[model samples]
Target chain A: MIFTIVVVGGVIGAIFFIKPVPKYYTRYGVELGTNVQITYATSKGNAKQVVDEMFKKFSDYEEIFDPWLVGSELYNLNHSDGKWTKVSPVLLTVIKDSIDFSKLTDGKFDPTVGRLIPLWGFNTDNTRNWHLPSPKEIKDALKHVGYQNVEIRGDEVRLLNGVWLDLNGMMEGYIAQMLVEMAKKNDPNSTGFVDIGGTIGIIGPKNGNEPWIVGIQDPRGNPNQAIAYVKLYSGYVGTSGDYERYIIVDGKRYYHIFDPKTGYSNDYLESVTTVSTRSIYSDGFGVFSMVAGEKAMKEMAQKIGVAYYAINENGQVIKSANWNEYEYKK
Target chain B: MNTKNKFFSKWDLLLIVFLVAGLGIWIGIKQFSPPAAKAVILLDGKVYKVIPLDKNAYYKIYRGDTYLMTVETKPGAIRATYSTNWIFPQTETTQVSVATGWISKEGETIISVPNKIVIYTEGSKERTLYDAMTYQN
Candidate 1:
């Protein structure tokens, strides 16, 4: 009788706790930006429809596939040429948010490094290419990269100079936020996750139960590995890496995550991943912390009220004072 | 047909109705549900399929060409690489490996093997590992 009770109890536990087996799942896919796929799954009525509408409402491609058009318009506005051109509310909003990040990081987080891409030949496909920028060139770029250059009035915007804005740092995070908002609309009691360009956002736990497990990507792309897994309950995460962009030559390494001051990559750290309530903060600070290094990161984490985990150039792990609070499976 | 054998009481009718409805949904899910999102992993000058089994079921895994793994997916996790003899894994190569949850001192994914790494990208196939290199732009 005791053995029977044990077997029955075990069966009941599995039935009640484990994710339902042989359960039905539906997925919807939509491509945005450099090709992002948002998948929505539920075994209920019209799961795919909800995801489809969500995609329609949110996209960072700036109207269409024409990057050059968006780039030129945004650059003209962000630079000293904002006195002209009709600025979209979307661009204005993102610029404002980026400005807030720059202030929060004390200029450590900047968005004006747009031309850096073309300079490195990332604008088009040319593998055998890379040109190091001189300090003077970097200084010139810096003049155009500050957040203050972007001025926004009631409904208009003004650019301080010929500055260009690169929203790549926060674009993914913004998409993630939109996904979470969409998920909440369908079921007041549901679990959802969205990842756009490595920026991950979540809406509650999985299936109205259990926390969502999010893995932080290793900047080095070592393979079959993860730096950390933090259980998320409606929050944001972002990663910046020295390994994010680089060039190899004669067995040497050079990356593109540049410093506004040096006109070259920040060397103090290797990778920085941050988690916070806001995706902008997470994404911006993730890059900010990498450029700022460990000492500055301690202060950055406190300033933003978030948790951070970073890897140094020599392979060292350092977390902000509050990192333990958010680490789930560490 | 025999009348008595074919006839059903109200209680029996209710039970059958419930069972049929429940089973219909279950079977429908098994039958008409859309195919899993496909991702073409570019690695070693070839494309491999990555079936991301995201526990949350809402994360879509993308490769070089299209979707690599669907969200809310729970595919089997790879604790370790299952390859015996391997080949060269270069910058644009791709591979499908599970999160052993293993990390390095620098906290990057450590794929000790060549075939274990795959890159996912856009336009150019193998998006995942394709852009892994650190381009100090």
Candidate 2:
């Protein structure tokens, strides 16, 4: 009888002591042309304030980064008519990082391919009418597609030969990093995550023990299905996949990750996902790997000291040596 | 008499076994249970509506009664149809065919960005693909 009472008391104590931590989630739709979802665990219950501030910061960054927006700093720089244009520090930093990535990937990840984006109708929201650009048009766009054409001296950026800069490839990751920082700043002890589109950055570990599990979308599967999952404790994960935005014509798929060499979408990869300590590198490398293919992606992952998972056009999944370490096994 | 010999008595072992069994059963129920079928609609970031997935019904969603779209829910599945919203500032109309496909699984989302509408299915077993997903615009 005493033993039964002790066991009952122990069970009751365990149930009370092991209370589940409350987690707050805020989902904001249609911010910066994509959805933003933030999840945080904090005793202060200030998730709404943190998310509001993050969205406000996103608005500020969009004004600086959006090249198509008429009043954006990038738009002004693009229309500067071969003259040196003073840019914001954020723009300058991202541009410099873009150029560095361009060089690092041997122009596989060029920001100057902005001219080619519209030539193939990728810049337009109307993808229904998207078509292949004429060879002449592609050739003409190619003339302006070189990262070297961008001249940056301090805060002033100049486009030699009228090369337009598109930071779309790297902007979301940067914004995600900023949002994560905002979450941490709002409450240092808080644990959370920020997902802008598909680029993700963790503010800290979830539930204070288990790493955050993220699913990699299957290129051929339905929107909700993941080919696999990766566990993130902190840092960022960015995926570039043709399946997300693509035009199908005559059984051929054309998506927006452009190859500066051909002024067309690279046909090598279906998707590439990069995990890195820094959001910028994760964004840049994911795009780079999509264009560079499997062998180069593996080498780059090793050289850059980041984890990567790539799916080829044949739908074969490839992973870096360390990628399995981050896999969330059921 | 050494106290170590009495440290794990039959009662202690029985208690541990019961605790472990209870935890296993809880985890099993949590992981393997089929999620409750429901479709959550969000308009401009707030929950616009939540429809049960167990019944056949058609719901007309509107932005101030403008009749933006119709959502069809069947037993265990949901889909969007009859959308007339423009695809942003561009010339193309929002294609209902793209949004018309049935979404029954967890984590599946149907989004019409131009209309500021998002529809996602949820269940107890529906797991998020990632803590967050980042993709190109």
Candidate 1 on A211-304: residue-level lDDT in tens? Answer: 5566666656543345676666668776777553456444455566657666566668877777789977767877787677788888767766
CAPRI level of candidate 2:
acceptable
Tens-place lDDT digits, model 1, residues B1-137: 65653345565566567768999999998777643333233333234445442232334333455433332223322223332222113332122233333221111222212232333312211123111111111
Off by over 4 Å in 2: A1-20, B1-37, B64-67, B82-100, B104-106, B122-137
Q: TM-score for every candidate vs. truth?
A: 0.65, 0.84
* Candidate 1 regions with alpha-carbon error over 4 angstroms: A1-39, A42-44, A57-60, A64-80, A84-86, A123-131, A134-139, A249-252, B1-137
lDDT of 2 by residue, A1-330 (tens): 465677788879999999677576656576666666677776665667767767678678878987888988988998898898898878888899899989998898899988887777667555554567889999988998899999988789899998999998788888888778777877777887888877889888888777988888777665556778889888999888887557665667778888789877878888888889988987889888778777888888888899988888887888888888788876
* lDDT, candidate 2, at A186: 71
Q: After superposition, how far is residue A82 of candidate 2 from its true place, in Å?
A: 2.2
DockQ for each numbered candidate: 0.06, 0.28
Which candidate ranks first by DockQ, i.e. highest?
2
Against the reference, the lDDT scores of all candidates come to: 0.55, 0.77
